[model samples]
Target chain A: MKDRITGLFYILAVILLTTIHSIELYIGFFVLLSVLSGKDFIPVMKKTFVAVALFNGVITLAYILIKGFDYGYIALINLRVIDMTFMTFLFVRRVNLFRLFEFSSILTYLLVISYSQILLFKRYYTEFILALKSRSIKTPGLAERYGFLRSATGFFIEKSVKNSSEISLAMKSRGFFMD
Target chain B: MIELKDVSFSYQGRKAVENITFSVQKGEKVVILGINGSGKSTILKIINALLFPQEGTYRYRGEIITPKKMKDREFVRKFRKEVVLLFQNPDTMIFNPTVFDEIAFGLRQLGEKDIKEKVHYWADKLGIFHLLDRSPFELSGGEKQKVCLAALLSLEPEVLLLDEPTANLDPRSTGWLIDFLYQLDITVVTTTHNLGIALELGERGLVLSENHRLIYDGNLSEFLKDREKLLEANLIHIHRHRHDDMEHRHYHIHDDFS
Candidate 1:
């Protein structure tokens, strides 16, 4: 019951953040979140910044260039995104999404399988970079870099196709898609 | 030719390696033994200089190796050429368009001439001569592994660090690899969780316990003989079964029936 309530609460917060444009409320809420984050304040903030910095920077720059200088408008746009992101992060950290989504069995099943795949591929990608670093006798040239990128992309594409079919077969075998 | 003093490393807030200290003399074969996440691969990374030690010093050929030291172009060229690492996944090590180019990459990078001759030499030696023109991406797992090995061996590295080299190999490929590795004169450090093959990989073993600490570093045969050390490293397990309707329990080493 608590998980479902928390899930709805986050959804409501997102709706409010998007629909309402009160800058003062956004600022206050962000401050409250930072304080609530407490020991994780720095790490959480860092992740939020990394996730949004480039994106927000480009939007802010484009807006200023197109419409001239406007501090209030810029602040509103940036704060809205930052707040939304922070709330999402905090909610994920505190709430178990699987439990929250228990109302839908299929959704929960998809999450379980995809989450595991996400983790595995993330490590595989890291290993690719480390492998290149380990084997490069000197700085990689342009041709080498291009080769690495091509091969990495090809590998992922092949893996995705193979894994999807394999997963589909497993799901079918388990009567997941039975008519 | 390689030394690590009080080496320790961590990922995020969790410890991966804790106060690991060891040295490998020229031409020494050492096997790093640990279960998954027990810091076997992390130790290999430190030795290969892919990951630097957070709380200790790594010295190669009497020079303290640091990220700063790796910045020197001359040193990087020398160090990388001298020490090479084969990742657990062969796909990660290979990215070239063709097997020939892949094997020739390191030599070409170092401005070495006769790349074709060297590439062919190692390819023939590793039994991948037939796959020279074929794309490495399309090869079998064992073939890809051989291609990656040929690529590294073509560089003629003195120290070879293999991370779970046989984790993806079949029985025949694994057997062939063991035989192939036995003939190599270079210093080899292999990491594996399989206690059965540890003896075949090297005479010496460095075992890491679950807590990410080095529990034992000595003769592997001696290590195998000691059941206490095997249990401490989680390399052995207690199994219960019934023989003719009689229930009994006995400890068994992983992948080793005897």
Candidate 2:
């Protein structure tokens, strides 16, 4: 029941934050939620700032050039984006994604599998990069770097397919998907 | 009761194992021993019906098993529940958010009542009860293996198929697992390249040659003493060395390091 409520709240928050037009309200809610979440505020703000800047920086610049400086509207759009991002971060930190989707076993399974696969991919990619670094005495050239990336990508793709198939078989053997 | 008669499989035209014939009686523990790339794991996959045999038939409890037959809903459910395969990598087998859920997953799928009781029983049996709420991903390699074992064992499968169960485990955990498996009264088919561990796990051994053939299948103790057979299977290599001060040279069998 708690997980369901959390899921509903996440959906409702997304809808409200996306639909609401007032920038001040978004800023206030974002700040209040961030404070209540009790997470490291500066780091959360730093990540949110980077994401907002990268996502809206170009659009804001283009809008200013075309429509002149409507400071209030531009600020509202930027703040809304940042606020939405922060809210999502908070939601993810607060709720267990697997439990949140407990109503749908298939969805929960997919989320878990995808999460593990992503972790595996990251581990493999990091190992590949570390191996490259260990082997190279000096900085690699463009062609060498390209070659390394090509091989790593190939390995990653092959491993992903193999890992997914293995996981599927393992799950099946354990009575999953029997229904 | 599982039987494979003249079973053969290939991957994209590359033959894995061929002309394999074996039958494991109920409550019997059998070990498949082979070096890397010898198709030992492929044989286990075939037994679990994850891969179908291209040429022969597999029988479970006197009924011939085939891909088409497995399509039947009832048979698939029963077969999966009765025969569980614990993957070599615990990471691949573990998909639940916590250890408790991981063990409970199989029972829930089978629609088994008293899921919490069964999960707790097996977790306690495997000495992982304390880790019930912990994420499986956060566990050590041995702990992960135990959690996976608990998950599969909780289902109380009739036939347990393990593929290199100790590959990622430490010596202490491996010892514990061997002892635990010995106490379990269940039919087990395990694969391993380690000759000593295979002897410890089971009385009968099926040795796969480098070319993916069942070169030897008999008493593991006798098989280990047969130096020529071990050499042919590439499980050991004969080496000769002479000390500078010694008058004689001696030849010794060097077991495959891996």
Q: What is the lDDT of residue B150 in candidate 2?
A: 88
Off by over 4 Å in 2: A1-179, B240-258
The TM-score of predicted model 2 comes to: 0.59
lDDT of 2: 0.80
In candidate 1, stretches whose alpha carbon ends up further than 4 angstroms from where it belongs are A1-6, A13-94, A102-105, A171-179, B241-248, B256-258
Worst 10 residues of 2 chain A by lDDT: A130-139
| Clashing residue pairs in candidate 1 (N, C-alpha, C atoms within 3 angstroms) | none
Model 1, B1-258: lDDT tens per residue?
889899999999899999999899999999999999999999989888888999989999999988899899888988899899988899988889899999999998888889999998999999999999999988999999999999998989999999898889988899999999999999999999998788899999999999999999999999998999889999999989789989999988767334
Instruction: Residues B1-258, candidate 2: write the lDDT tens digits.
Output: 788899889988998998899889999999999888899988987887777889998889998888797777787777777887877766555555688877876676677889999998888989999999998867898998899788778777898998898888877888899999999899999999887688778999999988888989889999988887787788875455568865554434332343
Fnat values, one per model, are 0.92, 0.00
lDDT of 2 by residue, A120-164 (tens): 787566545543432232345575566567656655676788888
